[model samples]
Target: MSKGVKTITDAEFETEVLQAEEPVLVYFWASWCGPCQLMSPLVNLAANTYSDRLKVVKMEIDPNPLTVKQYQVEGVPAIRLIQGNNILASAEGVMGKEKLISFLDTHLN
Candidate 1:
């Protein structure tokens, strides 16, 4: 994970994401997922580029089942854009850096 990205757990989900002052981009992934691995770099890039406007967090689904269940994440490389208590947008699968940036930009603006 990059310095701009934070690794969060189920216990910290509410405070880190739900109660965050800025918009949060939560990456729901598992260590064993190949697609998640592929998407990691793009996520990291987004984290670095959007550090000022967004809070990027990675949540390993294997250890954080409660949050995964709550979000109904059936696959790895799932991303949720959350602001305050609301989920603004969500996407699944591996995305390119441009697409990921566009995803965030759409909701951020």
Candidate 2:
């Protein structure tokens, strides 16, 4: 995780994302996923860039099966924008920094 990005667990998912005051971008990833490694830097950048408006978090799928199942994460490198316990938007696979920013912008405003 990056400086502004929080690495959350299943136990913290409710408070960190569901009840968050601001919008949260949750990155569902695994240590062995190639695309997830590729998407990490961009996620970190987004975390720092949108720190004021969005709270970014990373949840490792392997150890947090409950959260992954709850979110219905079918694949690694899944990105979900959540606000007030609702999912605003979601995407899967590796996305570039610009596209990731655009994704965040789409729901933030």
Using all chains and alpha carbons, the TM-scores for the candidates as numbered come to 0.94, 0.95
lDDT of 2 by residue, 1-109 (tens): 3348899999999999999898899999999999999999898899888888889999999999999998899998999999987999999999988898788888987
For model 2, the stretches where C-alpha displacement exceeds 4 angstroms are 1-3
- Distance from true location, Cα of 101 in model 2, Å: 1.2
Candidate 1 per-residue lDDT over residues 13-102, each given as its tens digit: 999999989999999988889989999888888888888788999999999999999988888889999898788999988898888878
CA lDDT scores, all candidates in order: 0.89, 0.91
- Candidate 1 at 34: error in angstroms? 0.7
RMSD to truth, every model: 1.9, 1.9
* Backbone clash total, candidate 2: 0
Deviation in angstroms for 41 in model 2? 0.5
